[model samples]
Target: MAEPELIKYRSATGRWVLLATVLGTSLAFIDATVVNIALPEIGRGLSAEAAGLQWTVNGYALSLASLILLGGSLGDRFGRKRVFMIGIGWFAVASLLCGLAPNIELLIGARVLQGIGGALLTPGALAILEASFVRDDRARAIGAWSGLGGIGGALGPFLGGWLVEAGSWRYIFLINVPVAAFVLWVAAKHVPESRNPSAARRIDVAGVLTGAVGLGGLTYGFTAWPMRGPGDPVVLISLAVGVVGLVAFVLVERSSPQPMVPLRIFRTVAFAGANLVTLLVYAANGGVFFLVVINLQVVAGFTPLASGIAMLPVTVLMLLLSSRSGALGQRIGPRIPMTAGPLVCAVALVLMSMIGPDASYLTDVLPGVVIFGLGLSLLVAPLTSTALGSLDDAYAGIASGVNNAVARAAGLLSVAILPLAAGLGAGSLTVSDQLHPVYRHALLICAGLMAAGSVIAFFLIPNRLAAHAPADTFCDPCSPPLRPADTVRSAR
Candidate 1:
């Protein structure tokens, strides 16, 4: 098939493409944040313990992280538009299942399915923009995508809070059906088809299986450790299996002719350093996003709507400042912003830890959230650009997928392990007396993680992307790369 003509960013077709991709990707992004706000309501409704709540969040992250690399590869070989539409349809169906689920077991199962659909579409949305837009307009198009998508993320908590208060936690998931249906119609009608002509036909089934099993085992072991103790046979076995599976995954990637994750990309020091920073920073992020809302409601005596609204500032700051930060990184270097941002966030987390029973929102919550927002806005764009910019354009898809997978996996593990590390026992997430101290300890740990990330950035990240980096390489913290590299596309 002939390559479709790349359109100008301001044209009608460009606008439609942007709208479809934004809405589709937002479904996944919003779901990630929104569910955190609804967790308390879901717990009360289902009579679930802390373990069940953690699983509800980690289940989605696990599937998405494990299969995201494969998802990018599939879109490259199949038509991107086709895979994206399929993902929307799949995600919508999974959301329905989650809404109607009668038990915690069914809800967690449905969440895993939703992650599968997220894995399929998240990279495809960015890839479509890279493939569909003219070279001159690509950067502008991506910048707009990032800013617009950030709005969805910013609104997620508030929307989820309102839904939970207005009626049921079920509406948070159910609302996606109509929005997704509209996205599907727009995508099918206006989105053009594109693919990597040289993409590999072989799929790396072994890599995918091992990675999934590895993440699943580790997540289950950690989540169960607090309730069942480290000495429990089940926890021991799960931890053992997790270790073995991850080792096998690495070995498989090293030997496979067409690996799902080409281990060679890590050889680029900048790429490797950027991803390491991502792991540390996002691990802290995962803990904060997961626990802070719960703390506000359970410990601080805030309403659901109030807790959700508290987080709006972080997203708002990112939406407003991210583009300027990206430009600043390009002009000076990523190292300064990358290093300073996390340190700022570390300070913010320390402040957040001070909130307790009867804490005032104005004095206790607003200060930390505003500071955290400023730090995140500074960090995200540079980190994203450096990770992708370090590699050649051909590796864009794979690079984006790897970085995204690291972020998701970091969040998955943090949510599973933070409670145990903080000394919270079974079913203590909603208990104020037990939770207040645990929440304080957990935020301090997250602060340490962010501080460590800053250290990594200061020592490891370069002052600039490599000399050969693409001129049009622009940042999109919300999305990944535009296309797959030649090595990835032709692997056999």
Candidate 2:
């Protein structure tokens, strides 16, 4: 059969549109990891206190994590393209504001605005891809998209660090301006919008508010912990309130007419398991990254560029192999790679734990990076494919959004949990002595998370690829909400 005409693009326009979406998405993805390198410069420039510095980053993360599902849900309510372009535009403006900020207070505020843009832009691209391609081509498309982000993640620190060291931290934010503007223009022209048929399933206002409040409150408390030394009553109070809010949000979502999270989605074992693995894996990634950057610069006395470059091998390998992993996983199944990736990554973390500050990069860091990179390359594509493949076009945005939000929240939770756990003075002893144990301990903790992820993926995820089903199979007469995305159709 001939391929559908709508799915095809003028080769040049198609490539360009793909490029712009990549740029739009990468801006959020890389910035989240890259900005950690600039924190010292930002802190010095703004006379930022410890808490202020934490907020500068965590504020954006929290907003992104909390509001993401709603952001995707909103795209479905309006139009994917409509919400996406608005998000990129907002992100650009926020970047400008972040660059122009007079103090840490204002900088943190602008960062939160930036997070709002990220929430909007990310899911629309994923939804558009699902609508744009057939099941066979969909994995390839998502793999390519994720590969671009993996590359950006690898390159970000080196580029961001160089700019910070040569000039000011302002340059890091400034660089995003042209990138965002270009994406906004291309997205406005090329992207098509899609949504669920039931328009009456209006955006969930109460669910959105509760989720945002819960995440925001939790992040605020965590941000305060380092400054308050974790034991302060005010910090404790914030933590208590945040936990209560999250529980309350969960209950609210279960009852809302158009639930932001739609607890029903978890009925598919694959969908549920993949999201769980996403959370744990991303958390490990976040925690390890935070510790590595600090160890490289603060402990080893590397320049900013040096710190950024340290991540190159891991990022490069992941970018190169991610698509292959998806292709292979499609041929066989995700069971081996998904479970193995985290398991291998866990072993790599264990190796990383052994590195002393004085440890040679070749002997200590490079080996760990290669192992971790290969494992992640295998995991990302398959997990992403399976997660979205389980759903229909209509629910794609929010489905992807929920997983993405969970990933971001995992990172935020790591940011909140790791530093305090690591005892941040990593400069205490000689470079090797001080950093060695810190790296070891942090990596070991990540290993534990990965081990858990491996088990969850093994048991919870079934042993087959997901496919879209037909109307006859839809909802089984009285099934609530929508059909489980992973249900198999009659093999017609």
Candidate 3:
């Protein structure tokens, strides 16, 4: 009787726990995307050139991606609750540091520390949710929470813009402080501690070392190569060392009793292919958003607030479609939307390439937003469903961590590479002023990459959803399917 009562209490508390996780997780996503709208403000305020501003965002993502899996491992080995509290506490502190930092260099450093804190929080947050919620409810909760993160990500720029318009860009980071404080407090009261019961007693130090060094060096080199010159020894050395470290990590994972990244999981085609798709999709997204933000502000001369408002055309649609795509995939299949969405995005990119500075938002940006949002929304729900469903329950934490890391890694890589795709990193100007041409070309590349992803999804994803159709709880409680059916029956 006492145990049942305890279970009921935990379940009640678990709802709030997941809510806190949503806040915490969404904070990271918002900082990454929405903040891009305000980069010009930050750049001007700090007297930073383009590169410095880029680093402020990229550095956080880079650190977060590299360390996330390890963070998950740490949470598993230690207590997830303990790690989570520490992560939240540190994240709040780092946000304050970022808000207060006097110099560009200090701000970037603080952002990196904040990433470290996010890395610790993200996986542990999800793991706790999964542990608390049972299977069907778990899927729904995850979908809803993931959708919430998406909404937060989409809503981020608007929030940042409002803050920038009212206060300094510093307020963007400072704003996170209160949100973080609330989440931390709620999490403290509600979230329970859990650990990997089966984990090896000893830490896999070798694997951790290799993963950090390898991923870090490779990502840095990719970002630096365009500006540093291809022949630069620093670029070559970083790449070479990164390659070696990666190989070493692979070897270590194979031999270790416990591993940071389990090598065997990649052997599954669905798992591996899905993650590959995730990488490519996120990479394109990361790069594309940056291009859009820069083009709007620099080329079009839109204010931070204006740029964010202009973005509502895309994100609102994304929220609408994502909530429903899961059911649509279940009824028919994932393939139709999967193939069509990217193809549409490709079309949008092509249209964007043709638009000049004088192009109207309706004619240029609107069409692209509609297409891109539809395409991306199609991709998100199915990709998430497939990835999670592909694995056994035992690997949930690992799978989520790996998938999240891949997406972040892809975003970071895109940031590094797409800027160079312009082929004018240091050409006639310090940075190309009218990057419309470059933006056009880069967006076209994104379209092409997305087109390729569509093909991969078509070929790789299973034709049918699971026998137990999981509802995307993040969406409307009444799915579209049941609504139409109910209407038809009422006529009888």
Top-lDDT structure, candidate number: 1
**lDDT by residue for model 2 over 161-195, one digit each (tens)?**
78988999998998889988888777655554456
TM-score of each: 0.81, 0.86, 0.80
Q: How many Å off is the CA of 396 in candidate 1?
A: 2.6
Better of 2 and 3 by TM-score: 2
Task: Give the range of the ten consecutive residues with the poorest summed lDDT in model 1.
Answer: 483-492
Runs of candidate 3 with Cα error greater than 4 angstroms are: 1-18, 33-59, 79-82, 100-109, 128-132, 137-140, 161-170, 189-195, 226-229, 296-305, 330-337, 419-434, 464-492
The local lDDT score (0 to 100) that residue 158 gets in candidate 3 is 71
Model 2 worst lDDT run, 10 consecutive residues: 470-479
Clashing residue pairs in candidate 1 (N, C-alpha, C atoms within 3 angstroms)? 394-484, 394-485, 395-485, 397-483
Q: Tell me the TM-score of model 2.
A: 0.86
Model 3, residue 201: displacement in angstroms? Answer: 3.7
Clashes in each model (backbone N, CA, C under 3 Å)?
4, 3, 1
Compose the digit string of candidate 1's lDDT tens values, residues 368-447.
99999999888887887777667654455567667777887787678878887898866579899999999999999999
lDDT of 1: 0.80
For 1-492, candidate 3 gives per-residue lDDT tens digits of: 111011111255646766788898888778866667678988888899888998997788768866787877776666566677778888989999999989899999999999899888888777665544443344445545666677787777778878889888989899888998998777766655555556675878999888878877777777677667656898889778878988998999999878876788787666777787787778878877777766776666666556655656566776666657655654566667666766777777776666555557777677877777777766676676566556543454566678787887677678767766766455421233547667777887887788888788778766654432211111112112222211111100
Q: Report how far off residue 437 is in candidate 1 (Å).
A: 4.1
